[model samples]
Target: MAGTGICCASLEEPIALMKMGLSMVLIGHVNFLLGALVHGVVLRHINLHKQARAMEYAISNVVALTSGLVGIVVGILAIVLSKNKKSKGLTWSLFTVSLTAALMAAASAIGLSVITNECPFDPTRIYSTTLILWVPLIVTCVIQMVFSARCFAVCISFLGLPCCPNRKRTRPYGRAINVVRPLKGSRPISQY
Candidate 1:
């Protein structure tokens, strides 16, 4: 009985961890992107041509926003799958979701890199704008990718769990232990 819990314990915890991590990442990413976009828009409206860096921020954010949304949604759905009573379908769904997150995150990262490289700091630039948001955006995307990987690992762990799943495999309800006979001649009592 003591060891009976090993399988279930291993699965339950990782699933919960995955769910929480993914949900947090999703919410944070949405808010952060929205704020970052607003900053870009405000800067652009004031003077776009003079603020090429702000434009870069706006374009990179727009590209990242779409993919970030997709990743968050898939991440949330993957969390939902963790609660399902029937885990049979879970592995494939989680696998696909996690894979999508990784790809989307990679795309976002690449887009940000391209924009940064294309818009290097120049001496001719007069107005200076703090560009701290870009690093965090990339970091958030990478975090999402990491959480997705964790979720996928949780899915893989399920594959190795005891085949019967949550259902107990004890003798049918009516069968009671027969204590009437001598404890002598026996198939070892240990199994019972």
Candidate 2:
């Protein structure tokens, strides 16, 4: 009986670590699936315009905002039900931060679309207003960085392995190459 108790106690930490890793993986997969679903819904329902009016642009923003909020809520619920307390807290924090960043992005996108009289999907005129374009991008970049740091710290604490950042720089020989380079240089760049 004593040996069995010892074995069970020893198993607890590994179980917790496995749960945490699975939580992270589940969150990432759920987010990706939600994004795909949102894209399909938008493509089916929303009309793309060569030139979208202010009202049409606002409608699109509303659709995006609603979809994002729904996804976050679903993610939070999933985490809360399946994850340990610490993992649940981390997931909730990430979801809240992402939602806040998305709101900022949506507002900035809408305001810029209104001001520039450009379609929200238009790459050229989106950055005509620096404040409207860059502020949300910076906010989101910061949120992403902070979330990554937190995830790495948690993984190091729980599993003793550092979590890898999602962004990767491709190097050829001694030269650095950006594989995901933007075709149009309209988006704001965030310096690490």
Candidate 3:
């Protein structure tokens, strides 16, 4: 909802919206770090046992699922306000939320490793190792990878210049094309 407001306000003035967007991005990153810390604490202290681990995993999964549902609600609200326009503000907010969720999952995995005092399950050891060894690592990696990729992509899009060249055709019938160049010689593209 905040993102929708910012984006709507931004349509009136690009500069203000740009500043707001940047701030939202920063807030998202901060939330991600906080979520990681929270997840680490929960996994380390709450889910260390074999039987308790199952319950903790279930609860965590429920929370994650609920978060996703909330994101969908926010997305829908943004869309309704924007009349179906692609909402950059809402996108930024959702991206931030997703990044935070991913970080939390990763922290959980790390905490689990610390508690186990053993290397996380290796798939190659499946035949020789216990089911307990295989399940947690596999599930953690799958969930972590999905969210990590999303967070990384959003971060790159916000902070880095486009890597793929932006090409434009000069004429409908002409063979010439132009590559719009970025401002150069100041700093690396990633810094901005």
lDDT of each: 0.57, 0.40, 0.42
In the range 1-192, model 2's lDDT, one tens digit per residue, is 244431232222444334333443443344334334434433234345533453454454444344334334433433343356356455455445445534543453444234454434434433333334334433333333333333333333433324532223344348665777655756645643
Candidate 3 weakest lDDT stretch, 10 residues: 76-85
Kindly report which residue pairs in candidate 1 clash with one another: none
The most accurate candidate by TM-score is: 1
- For model 1, how does the per-residue alpha-carbon lDDT over 1-192 read when each residue is reduced to its tens digit? 235432233334645545554664564466357536645643345455776665665565565676566666666666666566256666677667676766666666666655444443342322233234555667776666666666655665555555334433445557676676546767665668
List residue ranges in candidate 3 displaced over 4 A.
1-85, 117-134, 151-192
TM-score of each: 0.53, 0.27, 0.32
Give me the overall lDDT of model 2: 0.40
RMSD of each: 9.3, 22.3, 16.6
lDDT of 3 by residue, 1-192 (tens): 345654344322344334443433433343334334434433334334545534544344335333334333333333332342356665566456556655555544443333343423332433233334424443543444343444334433443337522233244566776765666666655688
Clashing residue pairs in candidate 2 are none
Give me candidate 1's TM-score against the actual structure.
0.53
Best by lDDT: 1
**Which segments of candidate 1 are over 4 A away from where they belong?**
1-15, 18-28, 31-60, 114-130, 159-192
